[model samples]
Target: MTRSVYVTGVARGDGRQVVELGVMELLTRQVDRVGVYRPLVHDTPDRMVELLRSRYRLVQDPATVYGMGYEEAAALQAEQGQEALTARLVEGYLRVARDYETVLILGSDFAGTNLPAELGVNARLANECGASVVAVIGGRDQSAESVVAEVRNAHHAYTNLGCDVIAMVANRVGQGVAAEAAGALRATLDVPVYVLPEEPTLSAPTVSQIVDTLGARVLLGDEAGLARDALDFVIGGAMLPTFLPALTPGCVVVTPGDRADLIVGAMAAHSAGAPPIAGVLLTLDEKPPPHVLALAARLAPGTPVLAVPTLTFPTATELFTLDGKLGAGTPRKAETALGVFETHVDTAELTGRLSVARSERVTPMMFEHALIERARADRRRIVLPEGTEERILRAAEVLLRRGVCDLTLLGEPDAIRKKAGDLGISLDHESVQMIDPQTSPLRERFAERYARLRAHRGVSYELAYDVVADVSYFGTLMVEQGLADGMVSGAVHSTAATIRPAFEIIKTRPGAAIVSSVFFMCLADKVLVYGDCAVNPDPDAEQLADIAVQAAGTAARFGVEPRVAMLSYSTGTSGTGADVDKVRAATGLVRERRPDLMVEGPIQYDAAVSPSVAATKLPDSEVAGRATVLVFPDLNTGNNTYKAVQRSAGAVAVGPVLQGLRKPVNDLSRGALVQDIVNTVAITAIQAQGGDGDRPDAGGDGQERTEGGAA
Candidate 1:
């Protein structure tokens, strides 16, 4: 039977999308094939379905996602009566549900639809579809008592209609009152009730959304800047000095286009980091002169400069009504929504109540989810050296928002703050710790320690003092001196600059021959470990064996089973060369060192990965067809192969994760994205949990395991 969950709301302002998105996340985490079905939708494109399809990588066709538009359903219900409407909705839903293990059914939004009693309609469809219900009630601008009554009333309404009410969510409740509302509901209702406080940022409109709402022309600002949320609107009617102080963080400045003084002043204030204004909106369609516009661009590079034909009063009126939405374009909003939902909801209890069966396969999304959950379970402090980089700051916001790990960003504190403010990212939380490498009190101490550690190599105290002030060295010293648990860098710095400090200070772990690196090749269905891809040009047989062992341990630490395949140009003695001989020798050394390990020698890539090829080439070998840890013969082959698979096979390559280190110090590519930084930081925190040792099964045992193709 296909398990189904119906998320419907009692009113239009319920903010039920948050509940729906959270449930979709929970479903994807537990199951491999999850389907989405919207029983009724407006004529506009379905934003929630698009977001789910993109975020979860769903293969369901867009045409099949929605049963019919609101007009069509309303007409059908009017012409043929309620029975025909119910039959049509059920048939459409079953068409989607039949192919998936579980389906998420989105109920109708009570917006402008001619259909009568939308809530009752949703309940009827849910009952007919045999789906459990998650009822969402709007608590916005309502008292705690009022919110509680509404939740109770909604539960009764659904249950009276024969819908299995699994849970009730009071979304957009006022701050400090969610606890009260939740307490009152729990006393009266038998089902689990979650209260999600209203998030102002979620409702704040982005600059891009403002442009669309007013039909304004954007003369400046990059995509990232346009995506920033506008928290407040400052109508610029006063003098430059008076207008400057009114500018707040994420505020948009509205002024006449002829007032270059106000425009320049606002941009200058934003550049000086008084409080990062969202952007400046010029009204009356009067653009400044080209020279002044160029100067404004120089003052704030990515700050949006928009022009609208309407006067200041009309533009402000429209801006007042514009609200940001959770859609395909706004991913940061989705993260914020998830963070808010997860904070107030007891997801474990809710999932248990829904009785969702966990899937055995570990897809890429599932693996990524596990990484974050495990890291959050045992929170650790990680230092990012590239503190002022835009991507790093954005990723830092996500990390803090998700409660993934505590962060120690190494840079000038004021500079980092100014950059974060410009990007509308708040570093005010306790989880974020900023430091200036040049002026930190620990600098002298780190200099002394670094000098002592490198004195044998003829490094003087003065030189060491200068070197320790660099962010990379400063971060590595923090990890070495126990100030931080791990370090992830190389976003703006070179890989050599990032890891050289680690090699000098942290050094290699005990019994480790040399340090190596591995990339977690996240294929569509599984994860494979490719080692020595980013380190070591060439190695002898002993060094190759050590790399293989280190890579295997890394694979197991992150929940990948290690069936070692010593990759070469040949398979099972079918070919001979110097490369083949080295692989053969390394395989022998691995079996000798770890007699219990499953390993194959001099295996070709085809035989190592394909069951049919293994049957013909090495039928008797256990590791030939089921290898999870692939140790490349050299760095050249490993690096190229991982990139090939990443591009050609559309795989997600997650590392260059440095192994064989005493403490966790991972490096990133120069072109790493914001999510890449987040993933690397999580990996570093997990590694810091004392799993990077010779024991291959150190972190693997007793940990929650999910089966899949990758990580």
Candidate 2:
């Protein structure tokens, strides 16, 4: 569904760009489609318009999202009550959002002193389209008192309008202010406080938010409206009726059949003689009270009436008991934002995660969606495992759907379609290529690539084609020969099972020999990247150096630059053995080969990673502590250590997001999670976009690049 966002406070040019994309990132979390509007702009000749022109595709007129850029706003200083002007410019803002599931309404930076007709009308328009308001405060100062005053004032301001202040967030504050600001907001505010950490900025669209917003449609609830900002006002119909008092004027939600009293009382209290009833929600196969409906018809006739089905009123009521408190400053703050969004958003949880734990800038020229689109190829061949026809088609053709990748699914046309129907995945043969290996044009191509390698061994061309084609090896041949840009397999195959075919055909990328596999071990909020899992069973120090370099590069591409800690059982200058020696040698080799990289090893995992241990072990080393990438001396140490971490610690292990093939070739573990498949597929698509000569999707073909998955 397309989402329309009304972002305000984007006065500065860069700040405006940041929010434009930031809002897009926020919407990408839930809404697949987007239409952004700015009912008004402060100033500067169409900065918003120019920004829109330079950056995003429009679902509506870009001018409507923002009117009167810097110069224009200044030009029309006398043009107060710019409703006609804004409405004229924003041609289809309402029309576009009218059909959308979730419309994101961004608040202008009026600072509460401006007229509501200008701001309130904009906010009210969101309600007109069944949208919610996400109000972000651009902190002009660090004085804690100022933030408190502003939030309290705004809360009362919005509350008096009979609108629930859905969420509260402080933006542009220095990272230092997070702890105290969050604390203050928690103690003072009745709602959750979210710190849009100084990291993740506004570069990429947040997939988590996109998925949640989109999936909210499936929920059976008393009210099915989105919270523009979960940190603001919260009113769950099925939750504990704890918000009875907050239901003054702007917002009130109640199950029509279950809580007739709430519906009647809230409406009576808020809309006496046509007071502002910002959001009047009725849920569960029920209608408003007859008298309440009669009263509403005469009073706030235009207020949005939200209705949802499925959940029982009492079961739904349990949600309102949440503390809604802001958390202390931590890396998980962003994760918390995601968590909070999931709970409050009317969408399904975005199970897919681009694991990032710290604050950093997202570089330019690399866009996640564009890459997803670019990975969709129109004329590509792919091999699908027997019954995975549905997921395979969905994933393989993400590029094709978005005009990115050419998808090929390896299966019989009838069989694949039948399987898709069984799995409840709507797929047509024309949408994707269902190539049956038993009889395909690539049959001969596979025979040629396979025969060139396996001919000496007693194998006929037809037999070679059949054998290679049936196994994933032929898929590898397809990728190597440019018939396909990448390959995703291992649904029914083991780690080694998946890589064997790719290894035989895909070969390693340029500049490296050793193929290493790394597992993205996410222990909830913390992400641990461990390498040398799949490929090099026994790697020398030089080969280990390449692996470390490759792994670190991969980490950086996913927006996590590597603080590499080359792992061993020992610490700095401690144990002496072939193992430790190899690790130390690898450390030296990495320095000699890629000195710009952050690498330190020949240490225990704790000593290499934790600051506490590092202080005692390698006090002055750059990468001794807080390492992002783990470089293992050999396959045994890399694979076993990662596996131990995955099983014993119960980490959510995501493989090999990257495979350093000539293209984006990645192997899936036999028992991989659906999330794992989604993430790896995304990574592969990104990597594939980087290699496609037809388009420079990455920074001139900039996307995540992988190396050494041992295959």
Candidate 3:
């Protein structure tokens, strides 16, 4: 967690690059490739050369890192050989310390001298590169606090280190004089004290840790679960060598053919997030011996095991490039291994394996209505109204032929096919059966109902059929009669013109009052639900409340967690009378009726957000600041407000995800886009899942669990 710390002075290397290497080796303990640099490197002592070569991977001898090798790859290549060898030595680093886990820079000891140039330069690098300096004081025989005085002196050399010196590590102190120096140093220094013991491997992360960090799920070896940033693993076991051809680039898995033991063991371990096993080859059909099977159950449960009947060495070359991908239907072994990992020895790796999984899917879609896999196996019937002649017939063929849905066009077959050919729609005459507007079986029933509804105007039976046939409410009648699951129209009609027949034919959602509309605003970052923006120009208090509840509930069906926010110009008691009262009254109604809902507002934009402001207003309200569903006061505010928010905020508004239709029927805009038709089909499909005509929650549940924290 503590990034690169700048270590001043070196006891073992070039006094410059060696310290950088030493620190990098140490800091890779938890952070990846932390940057290293020397703020100032004046001393080029001979002992520094060998130190750099052996430990810092120096490729040259007598090479000055601060001068000729300053920008050189090896930094000290001349002192160690192979011209290009320098490239691999200090393979990756920046002159500036950068954001290292801890930047450890080496500085020449000033020894109370007044030049201060070396000390000053190091301090400048630390400051410019934004690093915290840790003075690594090294001496041959000094055990006195004066030896420690160099640390404090050099630390004060920098005036701008935001975070102060963490601690001091006394390197190479004789055991006999340790007590005296330790006691004196702690009493004098304000920072924490650290004693660097005789451990050669100070702090570099182990290969095991790197492997583990990469989430290497090892299906082999006892130390398989060990944490490693990177480590070498034999790609293929010497069995069934030909299987190596299938290996991708990732960690290697070793197994024996016919040894169900190796197969089961590898699969189980692979299922868990151990380092990847490149490829598994079977020795033959004999696998999963008693021991391996038990381990497999414990480790790679449900992981798909490939059986290669052969030996290990043959496939080694092929497996060296194996890479693993985790996906749907793949046993989410890591997430499932959390509880088991808690008992493992690799605490660091186990903790990651034990933690909740990182979401690999998109956040819940805002409108759950129903979705037919637009490109896959899922498809449903989408009706195109009559008179929409060109677009309607075209839309239906697009839905049917492209598998967006099963198509049901509302016009007479002859007319539909003729128009389809004209518009390039491939709808076969057989595909679009004729529902003679005049002679269809339901015509008499529709005529009876239509004439009765419009009878006050003295409409006759024939006139009723003419009226019903004119707009293709005749197709909606099919939906009412259970001949079709749903209908979508409005291509040649206004929103209300398309929706009116649906209302008369299908009726209201069970127990619902006013059927309203909402649009799902999906952004690359977040999703929002805005209600009644498409319908109900000015709903009273009760209607507004219903819209809020319905929008939130509809969001729940789409896998969104509903945090209802009743929006108005004023936030929570800030404004008075009609408009504010409408929202407030709506909020009250939602709370009293749907107490399970987290509803807030009569809240202003700032307070609805700005947690600081929200804390001042409705500090105790759960949904006050985090409300995901907003119910606006009236249509003008809701529609224009959502549009403004969408346009200004770069949101993609989907829907008028029309809610409260019987079954999953919906109305489209006359000017609907191609994508709009696709989205509407998906929504209608979502609406068809449950037997209930109402749009149940996406998962078919009626309510959202507040604790799920979706949306």
Better of 2 and 3 by TM-score: 2
Q: Rank by lDDT, descending?
A: 1, 2, 3
Clashes of each: 8, 69, 91
Local lDDT at 579 for model 1: 91
Worst 10 residues of 1 by lDDT: 701-710
TM-scores of all candidate predictions against the true structure: 0.94, 0.49, 0.46
Q: At residue 112, give the lDDT of candidate 1.
A: 85
lDDT-better candidate, 2 vs 3: 2
Residue-by-residue lDDT tens digits, candidate 2, 276-380: 233444446566556756664443333334455535454235423322211121112222333233222222111112111212322122234322333333233
**Every candidate's lDDT:** 0.87, 0.52, 0.51
Error of 1 at 587 (Å): 2.0
lDDT of 3 by residue, 598-653 (tens): 88878876666567888888899887767678887877778787778877977767
- The predicted structure with the larger lDDT, 1 or 3, is 1
| C-alpha lDDT (0 to 100) for residue 688 of candidate 3 | 64
lDDT of 1: 0.87
At residue 54, give the lDDT of candidate 1. Answer: 86
Report model 1's TM-score to 2 decimal places: 0.94
